[model samples]
Target: MQYAQLGRTGATVSRLVLGTMNFGPHTSEEDSFAIMDRALEQGVTFVDTANVYGGKDHRGRTEEIVGRWLARTGKRDEIVLATKVFGEMGPGKNDRGLSALNIRRAVDASLRRLQTDHIDLYQMHHVDRSAPWEEIWQAMDLLVAQGKISYVGSSNFAGWHIAQANETASRRGSLRLVSEQSLYNLLSRSIELEVLPAAEHYGLGVIPWSPLSGGKLGGRREDGVRRRAADRRHDPADLTEQLERWETFCEERDLTPGQAALAWLLHRPGVLGPIIGPRTMEQLDSAIEAVDIVLSEEDLAALDEIFPGPGGPAPEAYAW
Candidate 1:
């Protein structure tokens, strides 16, 4: 796998990041371990997980699983470990958000669960509109000072909000976001209008989630769509209706919907990497193959012609 620098951070990461959202709950533990092992063997050294994934009851099972695997494998120094915070952990009101107190509490919990002292990249899962940027950055700064987190990032944040946070960090000389994790796929292009440009402008590495459009682009039935009608994981109500036009466009281009979709995003200039979560080794193999497939200018033009803006008749926010 090709490696690139993670934004302005000195650390380098593989072009593909192995996401563990399905590790604990949806996927069996055995399958998770096999996937982890295969990814490492295949040279994918960047592994990302969140605190909320592992188990329905225990939480942090995904990280714990990684910790155990790393311990047994004795390859802790071989991979770049990245994880997130800000999702609600339990019933308590303070169990979530990016406030200083909650950030402190959350980092300690994450460290214990991951079986590691320093996180390579610690990210805010989403913007906490309730908290000031100062509060969030201060908490992140403390983690850096304590050697708990090496670098910080943001996810699910708007361009304006990220700009504000960058400004705050620049003035205060705190650790700024070195990267961003957000949804970007063939079927979803909303980030291109705002987030992508912002990341490019600020020199932030853009780690796009759902490069396959959550399996929809891969010509698979999106299971998440069946689970939640309004699920952004697969079919956003407005965007799904637009899929007909998109699929037709892909067909005319002589490309499978999945290939066409991933190719378009991969060709975009600022994209640093894509997070692809495949349940089976076969699915994983197919997605990794996308790295080798190149799209022509005509193919890209054809896709751009399908939905030039926010996609279909949907408002931009309807996607995320």
Candidate 2:
């Protein structure tokens, strides 16, 4: 697998990141371990998880399983471990958000669960509008000084949120956010309007989540499987037509829909890598192969004709 520098940081990461959202929820412990083993063998060393993963009843079970794998294989140093905070982990009111108190408690909990002394990247799972950036960055800065987390990142944040947070860090001379994890796929290109540009302008690595649109672009509709629910902002019939055209386009290029979809994200500007959350070994293997499927200019034009993004970006996509 090819490795690229994560944003402006000196550290490099795999082109494909292994997401562990399904670790203990949809996949069993044995299967998760096998999938991770295969991933390392295939050279995918960037792994992402969250403190609120696992399942409804098994909140931290996923991290526990990953911790076990790390302990058994002694591969902790071989992987770039990433996890998220700002999610409710217990019954207390302070169990969530970016408040300094919650951040302090959350990092310790995550470290204990993952069986690691430091997290390579600790991200805010979502923007806490109520918490001031001063408190947030101060907490993260403390973690950095304590060698608890090396880098900070954000997930599911709006464009302005990235700017505001980074600006605050800049003023404070604290470590700014180095990466962003956003939902961007063949069916969901809304991030192009502002998020992608903000990330590029700030020199942040864009790690796209759900690059397959939750199986909508996986080519299952030909077998009569319905499209994963419509986005409400779009017409169902229009989306169905788009998917049909996309599937045909992939077939014409001799690519699986999943591969074509992933390749599109791989070639997008400002994208570091797309997170591949595979439940089984086969899925994992298929996702890794997408890195080699290069899309031509004509192929990208055809894709645009099928599922167009927000024209270009911001005002240029709308006004002058």
Candidate 3:
């Protein structure tokens, strides 16, 4: 697999990151282990997980499963492990958020669950409006000094949130965020408005999650099929048309819809890689194939015509 520098950091990661959100709840431990083994075999060194994965009752279960795989194969040093915080992990209100106390407790809990001494990337699952940047950065700086986490990242943060957080870090002369993870896919291009530009300007790698739009772009759903039941909600006719065009585009190139979607993200500016959350070994193998499917300029233009983004970043997309 091709590798790229994660933002301005010295570390290089695989072009495709393996996501473990389905572990325990949707996939069994044996299958999760097999999928992870296949990922490493296919040269995927980046694996991402969150503390609140595996459903409410099974929170931290996915990390435990991953930890077992790491122990069984003794490949802890071979992978760049990433995990997130800022979810309700306990019965109390203090169990979540970016408060220094919660961060301290959460990191230790995540480390224990993952069976690792240090996390390669520790990401905030979402922005904590109540917690100031000072508290957040101070906790993160302590973690860095203690060798607990090498780099910091954010997930589901807006453009201004990234700017504010990084500006705080810059003023403190501490390590700034090296990456931003957001929901970006062929059907969902909202991040193209401001988030992508902010990440690019700040030298942060953009790791896109939900790159397939929850199986809508995975080629399993029939073209022109309504996403929701008519009784539940009205499906947009334009979305169905877009999906039809997307399917035709993929078929013309002899590529699966999922593969084309991933290739699209890989070619987008400021994108380090797209997170692929595969439940089975077959899905894992299919996602890895996207690394080799390069799209030409004409193909990219066709895709733009199918699912247009915000036109371009920010005011240029709107004004002068």
Please estimate how well model 2 matches the true structure, expressed as its whole-model Cα lDDT: 0.92
For model 2, how does the per-residue alpha-carbon lDDT over 7-113 read when each residue is reduced to its tens digit?
Answer: 88999999899999989989999999999999999999899999999898979999999999999899999999999999899999999999999999999998999
Please report how far candidate 3 places residue 302 from its true position, in Å. Answer: 0.5
Task: Flag the better candidate by TM-score, 2 or 3.
Answer: 2
lDDT of 3 by residue, 1-320 (tens): 99999999999999999999989998999999999998998899999999999888979999999999998999999999999999999998899999999999999999999998999999999999999999999999999999999999999999999999999999999889999999998778999999999999999999999888777677644575534322212244546767777878888889998889999999999999999999888888889999999999999998888888889999799897
Worst 10-residue lDDT window for candidate 3 reads 226-235
Q: For model 1, how does the per-residue alpha-carbon lDDT over 205-271 read when each residue is reduced to its tens digit?
A: 9998877666555542446232222236544556654666776776676766665665566687788
* Candidate that beats the other on lDDT, 1 or 2, i.e. the better one: 2
User: Per-prediction count of colliding residue pairs?
Assistant: 2, 0, 0
List where candidate 3 sits over 4 angstroms from the true fold: 221-238
Q: In candidate 3, residue 264 scores what lDDT?
A: 96
- Which stretches of candidate 2 lie above 4 Å from their native place? 221-237
- The best candidate by TM-score is 2
Give TM per candidate. Answer: 0.87, 0.96, 0.95
